[model samples]
Target: MRIGITLTDSRGPDALTRLRDELADAAANGMQSAWLSNIFGLDALTALAVAGSQVPGIEVGTAVVPTFPRHPVTLAQQALTTALAVSGRLTLGIGLSHRIVIEDMLGYSFDRPLRHLSDYLDALLPLLDGEPVDVRRETVRAVAGLTTPRVGRVPVLVAALGPKMLRLAGARVDGTVLWMTGVSTVRDHVMPTLQTAASEAGRPPARVVAMLPVAVTDDTEAARERAAREFEVYGTLPSYRAMLDREGVTGPADIALIGDEKSVRARIEEFGDAGVTDFVAAAFSGPDAARTRALLGELATAA
Candidate 1:
């Protein structure tokens, strides 16, 4: 599997600089890709555009940019622009987010997310391919075309977990970018459902990019405790909770790759064995951060 790392979640005045250095270091270390999340702080696509402009060796992507807030046309435009800025190396990962965040926080309904994704892709894909779009589905409508130069076709991946979402992703887009999901879940549920749909649709094999917290340490219990504390919110989220249940794990910490170097390396290999195309490590080892990074770099080089 191709190995990658997430950008540091550093905020404030030096966040951009820190991310730029991280990207450069990853490329220099032979990492295949670097992923950025679109959460609260800086916009992920814009940040990647700026940071990625200087480092053109490794691929850059968003773990996800939510589709609710931005129109399909607008997002296509932005993604294309960012792709151009980054030397045609942008994989646009998008998702429905969650009902709590969409309704309570953003004041947008999260109803019928599968249908929304289908409609959103219908509009967004064509625009990204430099074609005219005139689709008007129930959840999305785009009747415009972009004049931007083609920076190759921007590959799209959806953050999918449930069956419907996976089927839609396999049929409509390139693949799925997963988080809080384990190897067993990917092997039993994700691969079967996604690959079948892609095959039925006459598409090529789907890509599965798995993102999980990783730590390299001998103190297993301490690392597990730290992961439990740092990533508690994911255990409560319904979609992630469902995957945790499917993996037959109690919480987020159970799926995390935490242990000594050998154990952690073995766990990472398990994901590749289960058909993961790429493994993006979200290292959260605190004091062991540098050690964890060194391991990831070594693994990336080996991969």
Candidate 2:
């Protein structure tokens, strides 16, 4: 399994610089990939582009960028531009963000999200592959007049959780970038669904990249408290709450990987056994960034 680190876009003032430094450090420490989250701060693609120049070898990816905020053509163009700038080292992870965020926050109608995503990927994939895209659908349409640098084809990953989306991801996209899903969920639910879909579709088994909160410390109690506080908002969110409930976890502490080196390593192995091809550790809230980095470094080396 490939071991990676997730750069948190949720905090710090010099986020871009910090992300660059972290990627460089991770690369130096022999980590295979580094992923950036698309939450409220710096855009994931832009951050990856900036970090790509700084760290040459490590694979850089977006854990996800919401699809509702941008059209398929626009997103395809942006992803291609970033891929070109990075010399084809970008993985574009796209998703239909939750209804509450789309409807309540952005004031966009949330009906037919699955259809929207299907249409978006159909239009967007051809564009990324340098094929003329001329498709008209209710939610998405693409007129193929634009040209990209054609550096290389950027791999599209779907941020998928449920059955329909996971099936779509297996059939259409390269992989799924999963968040807030535990190993049990991945083993019992996600892997089987994706594998079956891929097998039925006659495609290679879809990559399952698991993103989780990780805090490596002997003070497990303190780490759990910090994780619970840091992930408070996610615990309250409807979609994530449903996933947590399915995992039988009531709080972030239940999901977070917190312990000494041995225990953390065991948790990572558990994820691997559960069929995660890649593991991206988003270190939990803490005072010492260096300590977190060191812990990741140890894991990377040991693995």
Question: Which candidate comes out best when scored by TM-score?
Answer: 1
Q: Write the per-residue lDDT of candidate 1 for residues 32-82, one digit (tens) a residue.
A: 999999988779999999999989889999999999999999999999999
CA RMSD, predictions in order: 0.9, 1.7
Candidate 2 lDDT over 1-303, as tens digits, reads 888988767457787888888788889987888898787889999888887877898889987899988988888888898998788888888888787788889998889888999999888899889888888999887877458887877888998888898899998888899888888889988999888888889999899889888887878888888888888888887667767888999976799888877788898899988889988888766755566667677766776
Measured against the true structure, the TM-scores of the candidates, in listed sequence, are 0.98, 0.95
| True lDDT of residue 242, candidate 1 | 99
- How many collisions per candidate? 0, 0
